[model samples]
Structure formats: structure tokens, C-alpha cells
Target: MAQTISVAGLRKNYGDVRAVDGVSFEVDQGEFFGILGPNGAGKTTTLEIIEGLREADEGTVAVLGLPPWPRNSRLLPRIGVQLQASSFFERLTAREQLQTFGSLYGVPAKKADAMIETVGLTDKADVRVEKLSGGQAQRLSIACALVHDPELVFLDEPTAALDPQARRNLWDLLREINTAGRTIVLTTHYMDEAEILCDRVAIMDRGKILRLGPPASLVRGLDAPTRVSVASGVLAEDEAKDLPGADEVSDDDVSLTISTRDPSAVVAALSARDALDGVQIRGATLEDVFLDLTGREYRA
Candidate 1:
């Protein structure tokens, strides 16, 4: 597939702080790509540069074979951007907001109103922006970005403020859009969201990419031990430690967890001992890979 967005040696600085440091990546046409990072990790900065919202101090960015800086008018009609913070025209109803945004791209008012249904805000279509809940406002902002039917969409922490149900609903909506051939670039703090939605993800920290690959591939490459947990009191800690293939064991009252490279052996031993109650065998996940790369230290 052809590249929809490309960045080479991208750099951005905010006075003494380097917000983005030599970032380079590509998003292919119709692909769902994710940028994962903690706060101050440069995900938003890199996104802004590619969306033509901010200028990069160094390196190049091409959106659909055109430069993104200088506010490329040609690119504007072909791309949609949903910022991390939802912003809308003051006092406009949800339907009216969509209609107004769609008008800028020559979309009809009726078509725009229909998009309100797309984001599951049909009942709230008449509600003012400020009156809507955080999730509803988020849905409206997403609808506005998508009202133009742009081929490429940029979503910056699109579900940050949403409840679990709302987040899953938006995830379904995004999957539908991507399935319909729209390329999507997403920046998110949720590891599970990135793992579920992205075809490939770039994990960034301290203004640099620490790892980049498909979520499953990255997790498999970690070679981390699998963890098997069962209800506490299944066996004494000493007995658990002596279980076949157990590399490490710990009990936290609620559950007894055994970490082992040979999960099959450990599970078989647990089965033999009839200690399989509440058993949960878990392998390495994207979050594990993320923590391994970025460390557990909180980022501000």
C-alpha cells in the first residue's frame, strides 16, 4: 500500500525542552496506526506537526505526498483531525456543530446531521455543546472531524475522558471507519486500546520512540514469563514454589500467582493437584512490553 503519512528525522523544540527528537515513521493507506506514550512523551507534538497544526523545527513530513507545514490547503480537505481536547463553536447544538463543520468542506447539512447518528448522539443532537456530557462532546468532536469524509483521520487521545462503555462504542465506530478504507493515526495512553485497535504501534517515551511493531509481535518478542494465578490457599507457598516449572511464586491473600516459562507444565501440575479454581493463565501483553521499554516510573 502507498504511504499516507511519512515523517523523517522529525524534531520540535519548545525553548529548552525538545518536545520531539528525531522521530521517523510512516502510516500506510487504510492502515490503523497508533502512537503510545505517557504524558510529555511527544506523541501529541508529533501528531500536531503531521496534522499541520504546528510546525516542526527540523526534518520532513509528507501527508499524501505533500508537505504538511505552511498549512497545506490541499491536504486540509483530504484529512481530518480530532485534537486531544474537544473544542467546538460556542453555544452550537450538536447537529448544528456538525453541519457547520461539514459546510467548511462543502458537505450538505443533512449529511452532517446524519453523522450525528453515526457517533450515537442522535438523541442529543439538539443539545448545546456545553450541556452535553464529556463523552457526548467527544463523540460530537469526532463526528465533526469525520463529517468531511476525509481519507486520513488523526485522533489524539480520542477516548481520554470517556467511560468504558463510551470508549468501546467509539472503538467500534473507529473500526468501522477503518474497515471502510479510511487510514487512521491515533495517539493514546491506553495500552489495551492500542493493542486492540492498531495494526502497528510505536511506543514513545522522553520524546523518542522506544519500540515499534505489531502489538502481538512486540509482546511475543519480550520473551517474558507467563503468569498463572489461582485462588489463595490452593497450596502452601512452599508447595507452590516446588510445582513443576515454577520459576517464581507469590501469594497476595486473594490469589496465588506462579510465574514460569513453561506454562503448560505448571498448569498440568496445578490440574493434578486439583488447585485450578479461579485459574487465570496470562501471557505477555502490550502493556508488559510498554513497561519493559518505558519503565514503571510515572511520566508527567
Candidate 2:
């Protein structure tokens, strides 16, 4: 794939606070790349610099092989950005909103209808923005961002506050968009979203990129302990710990949690138990990797 965006040793500081420090990564064409991090992790700052909204203090930055900062008007027309919260003319219809935004980039205003349809907002195309539901409005915001059909799209927390079903719907739409060849750079704290949508992810904290790779690989690479939970009917924590491959065990009156990498052995050992209710087994996940690397959980 062609390189769509590139940054080397990128740094941005506000007074003494290093919002983005020594960050570097490359986004390939048509790749769904994600930046995963907690609040104040500089994900937004790095995105802003790459989107040409802010200048980096140091480092080389490029988008489509051109400088994205210094107000590159030529590049602006080729990039789309959906900020954390996109504002629209409250009274304007969805289609009209896209028309206005497209006009800003000198693109054909008629494409607004096409974009509205692309984002699944065709049913609400003529409805006032304020009258739309949260999900509908968010889709409209994306429609406006994509009105120009830009090659590179930057999305900051696209589904931040949406309910589960709405978030899933947006995820499907985004996957469709990416499959159609748009390079998407997303910044979100949702591990599941990143794992499902991103071809590659960069876990960030303290204004730096801590780890970068495919989601499954990052989790597997961390070598996080596997866990098996059992509802204790008569077996005690001591017996559970003494089972084969049981590395660490914790117990309560109702359940036992065994943390280990070799779950097969543990499961085999538990087969002889007569009082066990059932077993729930799970492997390490992106959350585990995040915690292991950063020593903290991802907080939105």
C-alpha cells in the first residue's frame, strides 16, 4: 500500500506540557489505523498536527507526500476531518449542511445528497440537524466530512457517546467506507472498536506512542495471563490453586478465579471436580496489553 501519512519524531508542546512528544508513525493507503489512549494522552494533539490544525514543534510530517501544515490549501481539499464533536447549523437540513461544507472546499454541492446517502442519513436528508437523534446527527457529521470524498479521513472519537447498537452501526458503515478505499485514521479509547476496525493500532500515553502493531498481535505479544473463572459449589480456592497449570487463584464465597497461561491443563484438572458449577475461560485481550504496557487501563 502507498504511504498516505508519515511523521518522524513529531513533537508539540504547549508551554511546558508536552502534548505530543517524539511521535512517529506511518499510515498506509486504505488502511484503518487507530490511535488508542486515555484522556490527555496527546492523541488529539497528534491528530491536529497531522490534520494541519496545529504545527509541530519538531519533526517531519507529510500527508499524501505534501506538508500538511502551514495552511496547505491544496491538501485541505484532499483531507476530511471529523472532530470529537462536530457542530452544524442547528436549523439546516442534513443535505443543506453538506452542501455548505462541500462549498467550503470548492467541491460540487450536488454531491451532498450522495454523501447523505453514503452515511445512511438519506431518510433524514431534509430534516433539521437539531431534530435528528444523536446517532443520526453523528452520521450527518460524517456525511459532511466526507462530502468532498477526500482520500484521507481523520476521525476523533467518532462513536464516543453513542449507545451500543448505534456504535455498532457506525462501525459497520466505517468498515464499508474503508473497504471502498478511503484511508481512515481514528483516535478512540474503545479497545473493541480498535480491534474490530483497525488494521493497525498505536497505543499512546504520556504524549508518546508506546506500542504499535496489529491489535491481536499486540495483545498476544504482551503475554498477558489467561483467566478461568468458576462458580464454586464446594471446591475452595486452595484446591483450585493446587490444580495443574493454575498459576494464581483468588476465591470468594461464590466463585474462584484462576489466572494462568495454560488453561487447557487447568480445565483438565477441573474436570474431576463434582461441585463446580461451570467454567468461564478467556484469553488476554487488548485491554490486558494496554494495562501491561502502560500500567493503567484505558479511560475515555
Candidate 3:
């Protein structure tokens, strides 16, 4: 497929700090691409540069064949944006707020009503924005962004601060949007959300991408071995060391960590000995891979 978004050698600096340094990537048309990182990792900075909100110090950025910066008014109407912090006239009804945003994009009032329905806010359409819950407000924001029938959407932390049910609802909504052939570019810190919603993800830190691929492939590429933990009383150091395929066994009085490529082999070996008790094998997840890659350092 043709590229929907492209960036090369993207760099941005904020005085002493290089907010985005030497970043490059491409997002294919109709693909759900995500930028995953902790706060202050430059995910937002990069998004803003590509959204035409901020100018980059160096690099090229193209969205739907148009330069994102310099305000491509013609192209702006074809794209939708849901900012991390979206605000509106608190007193205006949800439907009214959407109508106003739609007018900004030159969309008709009828289209705005349709958008409100599309986001499942029809029952609450007449409710004032201030009365809407956080999730309701977020859904309204998404509906407003889509009111113009944009081919591409940029959602920044769309599910942040939402309840679990609300997050799940938004995830389903995003999947529906993507299934309808729209390209989505989102930035989020939630690993589980990225793993579930994104087709491909770029893990970024300190203004640079550390890894980029499908979440499953990225997790599979991790070198960390699967770990099996047992209650400290279940096994002694020598007993754990003797388990098949076990490596780097470490135990205290309460628990043990046993690294092994073949968790099944260890399980089978333990099962044969009838020594299994409180054993738990866990496959490595994206969270584990992320911590392994980025370390536990504080990023302010």
C-alpha cells in the first residue's frame, strides 16, 4: 500500500533538551500505527510536528503527500485530530459543541448530528458538556474530529483517564473506524491498549525510536527467557537448578525466579517428579520487554 505518513531524520530541540532526535518512520495507508512511550519521551512532540502544530528543527514529515507544517489548509479538512487536552464551551450541549466544531471544518449541522450518533452519544446529545463524564466527553471529541469525514485521524491519549469499560468501548470504536478504511495514528502510554489496538507500534524514548514492529513480533524478539516462579518453600536452590532447561535460578525464603527457554520441559520434568506445587510460568509480555529495553530509570 502507499504510504499515508512519512518522516525522515525528524529532529526537534527545546533549548538544552533535544525533544525529538533523529527519528524516522513510515505509516502505511489505512494502517493503525501507534507511537508508544512514557511521558516526556517525545511522543507528543513528534506528533505535534507531524500534525502541523510545531515546526521541526530538521527532517521531513509528510502526511497524505502534503507537508504537515505551514498549515496545509486544503489538506487539513481531510484529516481529523483529537488532542490530548480538548476543551469546549462547558455550557454548550454535546450536540451543540459538535456542530460548532463541524462548522470549523465546514461540515453541515446534519453531518454533526450523524457524528454524535456514530459515537453513541445520541441519548446524551442534548446534555451540557460540563455534565458529561470524562468518557462521554472523550467520545464527543472523537465524534467532532470525524465530523468532517477525514481519511486520517490522529488521536492523542484518547482513552487516558477513562474507566476500564470506557476504555474497552473506545477500543472497539477505534477498531470499527480502522475497519472502515481510515488510517489512524495514535500516541499512548498504555501498553495493553497499544498491544490490542495498534497494528504496528514504534517504541520511543528520549526522542528516538528504540524498536518498531508488530507487538507480537516485538515481544517474540525479546531475548529474555520465560520465567517460572515457585513459592520459596516449594524448592531449594539445588532442586531448582536441577530442573530441566532451568537457568539462573535464584530463590529467597518466599519465591524463586527460574529462567528457561523451554518452560514446558521444566514443567514436564517437575511433573514427572510429582514435585509441582505453586508453580507459575509466565510468558514475557510487552511490559517486560519495555522495562528491559528502557530500564527502570525515572523519566521526567
Candidate 4:
């Protein structure tokens, strides 16, 4: 498959601090790729370099096979970018915003209007930007980005302020976009969103990618323990420890929890003991792998 975006030895610095350090990655044509990390992890810096918004201190980037530096006009029409903090033409209606953005690429007014419905903003088309809720404004921004139907799109924390329902709606819209052969490069802090939407993800921290792969594959590589929980007193803490394959066991007033590598063995033992009441089994997730790679310290 052809490459939509490519980066090699990408580096960027601000004053004495290195924002991006020797980062490299590629986004395949029509692939849903995610860059995930905590705050100030260099995700935005790397994305800016690829989007031609900022120049890299070192390294090369090709967006649609053309260097994305010095403000490449040729690449502008082929790519769409949405920042975490969406900026709109002040006082413009949602419909007007899309029309204005589409006009930049010579897209027709009707086409831009259609995008309003695509992003589920038809009823809010006449609503002024200032009157819209955060999630509603987010939908409008996304519609603006897509009104021109660019081949590649960059979304930075697209669902950041959205409510759960709104976030899931946008996810569906994004899936449809990728299904229609548009390449999407997304940066998000939501591990579940990346795990669900991205074909592959690069986990970054301290200006470098620590792990890169499909979410499931990365989680599988973690070999982390599975957690099994049941109602309190379903089994004594000592009894859980004696269960086959149990690595650790703990009991709170509300629940008894067991951690084990062999979930099947633990589950079988629990079943034999008739202690499966209110059972919940959870395997490792991308979030677990992310924490394992990035550590638990909070990032601002």
C-alpha cells in the first residue's frame, strides 16, 4: 500500500527542551492510525511537522509523497487538519463555517451543506458557533475539515470535550470516513478510543515512541495478569489464594478479587466452588500496556 504520511528521524526543540526526539513512523494510505500519549508527549509537535504547520529541527516528512515543510501549498489541498481547540470564524453559523472552509478548496455550497447532515448537525446548521455546545461545535469543525473531502485528515483530540453519546457518534462518522478510503491520523488521550478506531497505534512519551503496533497485539505482548472479581464473601481471601493458577488474591468489603495468568484455571476452580456470584472477568487492555510503557506518573 502507498504511504500517506512518512516521518524519519523527526526532531523538534523549543528553547532547551527537546519536544520531539528522533521520532519516526508511517501512515499507510486509507489507514486509521493513532498517536497516543500523555500531555506534552511530543504528539502535537510531530503532527505539526507532518501537517506543515511547523518545521522540524531535523528529519524528513513526506505527506502524500511530498515534503511537508516551508508551507507546502500542494499538500494543503490534499490534507485536512483539526486541532484540539477548534477555531471558527467568529459569529459564523455552523453551515456558514462549512461553506467557508469548503470554498477554500473550491468545493460547492451544496456539498458543504451535505456535510452538515453527515456530521449530524443539520438541525444546528443555522446555529451560531457561539451558541453551540462544545460537542456540537466539534462536529461542525470536523464537518469543515471534511467538506473538501481531503484524502488525508489529521484529528487532534477530536473527542476531547464530547459527551459519551457524542463521542460514540463521532466514532461512527470517523469509521465511515476511513471506510470510504480516507487516511486518518488521530492523536487522542482516550485509550479505548484508540483501541477501537485505530488499525495501529504508536504510544509516545518523553518525545519518543515507546511501543507501536495494533492495540490487541500490544496488549497480548504485555502478558499482564487477568483480574477476576466476585461478590464479597463469595470465597474467602485465603481460599482464592489456594485456587489453581492464582497469583494474588485480595478482598474488600464489596468484592473479592483474584489476579491470575491462567484465567481458565482460576475460573474453573471458582466454578467448582460455586462462587461465581456477580463474577466479572477482565483481561489486559491497551490502557494497561500504555501504563506499562509510560509509567503511572501524571502528565499535565
Candidate 5:
């Protein structure tokens, strides 16, 4: 696939803080790319730079083969963006708001109504902005973003405050957009959302990317193997070590963490000694990879 967005050695700073430092990545045409990070990890800064909202101190960025900074006039018409938080005229109805945004993008009012329907907000078209629920408001924001029928869309925490069902609804909407050949670039703190929506993700922290790959590939890269937990009995850590392929044993609250690639072998060994009171094996997940890479330290 052709590259729709490219960043090379991107850098940005605010006073003494380097919000984004030498970040580089690419979003292919029609692909869903995600930036995953903790709060204040520069995900938003990096995204803003690409969206032409902020300037980069160093490096280059190309959105649709045009420079992203200084508000590329030609590129602006081809891209859509939904900000993290959106506000509207309190008295304006949903249809009126869409019309206003559509006018700004040179889209016809007729086109705006179509977009309203696209976002499933037609029933609320005449309702005032202040009367809409959080999810309804979010849908309106998305509709405004799509009013221009952009080839690429930037969604910043689109599901942040939505209920579970609302989030799932938005996910389906996004999938429909992607299926129509619109590439999506999103920044999200939700791990499950990234795992489900993103084709590939870059994990960022302290203004740097620690890892980047498909979610499944990154999980597999951990190479930690499946873990089997069993209630602690008379088994010592050393005794558990006797089990084949048991790399480490950790105990807490009468439970043991038996790390081994071969769960069957470990289970058979425990069964042979009649020590298997309770055992459960599970594969690693994206959360485990995040914890292992970033450590358990709380980042403020």
C-alpha cells in the first residue's frame, strides 16, 4: 500500500519538556494506525503535529504527499479530523451544527444532511446541542469530521467518555469508514480498543516509542510463554523448579506463578505428585506486554 502519512525523526518541545522527541512512523493508505500511550506521553502532541495543529522543531512529516505544517491548503480538503473534545453553539441544532461545519469545509448543506444520516444522528437533527447525550454529541463530532468525505481521518480519543455500547457503536462506524477506503489515524489510551481497531500500533512513553508492531506480533514477541497458576501447597519454589520447562516460580496468597511454555508438561508433572489442587493456564495479552516494557511504575 502507498504511504498516506509519513513522519521522520519528528521532534517537538514545550519549554523544558520534550513532548515528542524524534518520533518516526508511517500510516499506509487506507490503514488504521494507532498511537498508544499513557497520559502526557506525547501521543497527542505528535498527532497534532501531523494534523498541522502544531509545529515540529525537527524532522519531516508528509500527509498525502504534502507537507503537514503551515496548514497545507490542498491537503486540508482531503483530510478530516475529530478533536479530543468538541464544542458547539449551545442553541444550534444538530443539523445546524453540521451545516455550519460543512460550510466551513465548502460542503453543501445537502451533503451535511447526508453526513448526519451517515453518523446515525438524523433523528436528533433538530435537537439542540446541549440536549444531546454524550454519545449523541460524539456522533455529531464524527459527522462533522466526515462532512468533507476525507480520504484520511484523525480521531483523537473518539471513544474516551462513551459507554461500552456507545464505544462499540463507534467502532462499527469506524470499520465502515475504513471499508470505504478511508485511512484512520487515532490516539487512544484504551488497550482493548487499540487491539481491536488498529492494524498496527506504536507504544509511546516519555516522548519516545518503546515498541511498534501488530498487537498479536507484539504479544508473541514477549516470548514469555503461557503461565500456569496453582494454589500453593507444600511445594517449594525449588520443588516447582523440578517441573520441566518451569523457568520461574512466584508465590502469593497460596498461589504460584509457574511460567512455562509447555503447560501440559507442567500439569502432568504436578498431577504425578498429586499436587495439582488448582491450575489454570492463559496466554499473554497486550496489557502484559505493556506492563513488562514500561514497568509497573506509575507515570503521572
Candidate 6:
């Protein structure tokens, strides 16, 4: 596949704080690329620079083989954007909003309605923008971005503030959109969302990308031990140490956390003694890998 976007030695500074420092990455054509990080991690700054909304202090950014800076006229029509919050005419109906946005791109009103249907807001097509719920508003924002049928889309925290069900619904819509062949670059603080949606993700912090790869590959490279939690610490230190495949155990009298690569062996040891109540075992995850690197998990 061809490269859709590329950033090299990207740097941005705000007085004393280096917002984006020496970052570089390439997004493949038609790939669902994600930037995952905690708040204040320079994710938005990096994205804005690539979107041509903000100029970097230094470095190079290219989208579709054109410089994104200065907001190139030739490039704008090929790019779509959905920010964390999108503003629209309060009195305009959902369908009307799309038509208005499409007009800027020379897209006809009929095309606008088709885009609205594409985002699944046809039922509320005539509803005013203000009357729409949070999820509905988000769907409308996506429709507006897609009104021109742009080749690449940038979504900043698209599912933020939505309930679980609404978030899942948006996820389904996003998958459908990607399946139709539009490349998507998404920035999200939710690790699970990135893991599920992104073909590859760049984990960033303090203006730097610490890791870049598939979520499964990143987790697998950790070489970290599996974690097992039990309801109570019934086994003594000596006993737990002798259990098959048990590497480490932290017992607090009220709960037990065992670290081991062979979870089944440890579970078998616990269950054989009728001490398996509330037992839970988990392998390493993206969050765990992040915690190991930064000593903190991704923020909301």
C-alpha cells in the first residue's frame, strides 16, 4: 500500500513546554491509524499540525504528497476532519447542516442527504442541531466531514462522552466507513478502542512516541508476567512459592495476586485445594505495557 501521511522530525513548542518533540510516523493508505495517549500528551498538537490547522515549530508533514501547512487549497478538498466538538448552526436541521457543509465543497444537496444517510441519521434528518443528543450530534459531525467524500478522515476523540452502547454504535459505523476504503486517522485516550479499531497505533507521551506497532505485537513484546488475582490469600508464602509455575505472589490477607507465565498450573494448584473462589487470570495488555513504561495508565 502507498503512504497516505508521513511526519518527520515533527516538533512543536509552546513557550516552556515542548508539545510535540521530534515525532515521526507514516500512515499507510487505507489503514486505520491511531494515536493513543493520555491527556496533555501532545496528540492533538501533532494531529493539528498534520491537519494544517497548526504550524509546527519545526519538522515536515506531508499528506497525499502535499505539504499540509498553510492549509493548501488542493489538499483541503481531499481531507475531512471531525474534532472533539463540532459547531454548527443551532437552528439548522441535521440534513440541512450536511447540505450547508457540502456546499462549501461544491457537493450538491442530494449528495449531502446521501452522506447523512451514510452516517445513519436519516431518521433525525429534519431535527434541529440543538435538539440532537450527544451521540446524534457526533454522527452528524461525521456526516458533515464525509459530505465531500474525502479520501482521508481525521477523528479526534470521536466517541468521547458517549455511553457504552452509543460508543459501540459509533464503532460499528466507523468500521463500515473504513470498509468502504477511506483511510482513518484517529486520536483517542481509550486503550480498548485503539486496540479494537486501529490497524496500528502510536503510543505517545510528553510529545514523544514511545511505541508504535500493532496492539497485539506491542503487548507480546513486553515479556511481562501474567497476573492472577484471587479472592483471598489462603496459601502461605512458602506454599505459593512451591506451586507449579508460580513466579511471584503478593498476598495481602484479603486478596492474592500471583504473577506467572503458566496460569493454568497456578490455577490448578489453587483449585485443587478448594480455594479458587473469585479467581481471575489475565495476560499482559496495552495498558500494562504503558504502565510499565510511564508508571501511569492512559487518562480519561
lDDT by residue (53-170, candidate 2, tens digit) is 9989999999999998897998988999999988997678988888999898777876777888889988888899999888888888888778888999999999998999999999
Clashes of each: 0, 0, 0, 0, 0, 0
* Model 5 regions lying over 4 Å from their true place: 228-259, 266-281
For 55-116, candidate 1 gives per-residue lDDT tens digits of 99999999999998899999999999999887789988998889999999999999998899
lDDT (0-100) at residue 110 of candidate 5? 96
**Runs of candidate 3 exceeding 4 Å displacement:** 229-238, 248-257, 273-280
* lDDT of prediction 5: 0.90
TM-score of each: 0.98, 0.94, 0.91, 0.98, 0.87, 0.91
Q: Where is model 2 more than 4 Å wrong at Cα? A: 252-254, 274-277, 297-300
Instruction: Check candidate 4 and list the clashing pairs.
Output: none
TM-score of 1: 0.98
Candidate 6 matches the true fold with a TM-score of 0.91
Please report the TM-score between candidate 5 and the true structure.
0.87
Q: Taking the tens digit of each residue's C-alpha lDDT, what string does model 3 give over 1-300? A: 999999999999999999999999999999999998877889999999999999999999999999988988868898999999998976899999999998998889998999888899999999999999999999999998898999999999999999999999999899999999999999997888999999999999889999999988999999679888877766678988988899879887777778899889888877786657788888878887778777888777
lDDT of 6 by residue, 1-300 (tens): 899999999999999999999999999999999998778889999999999999988999999999998988999899999998899986889988999999999999998988888888989999999999999999999988888999999999999999988899999999998999999999997888888999999989989999999999999999889887787656676777788989998888777888999989899988897778788888988878777765664457
List the global CA lDDT of all models.
0.93, 0.88, 0.90, 0.93, 0.90, 0.90
Residue 20 CA displacement from its true place in model 2, Å: 1.2
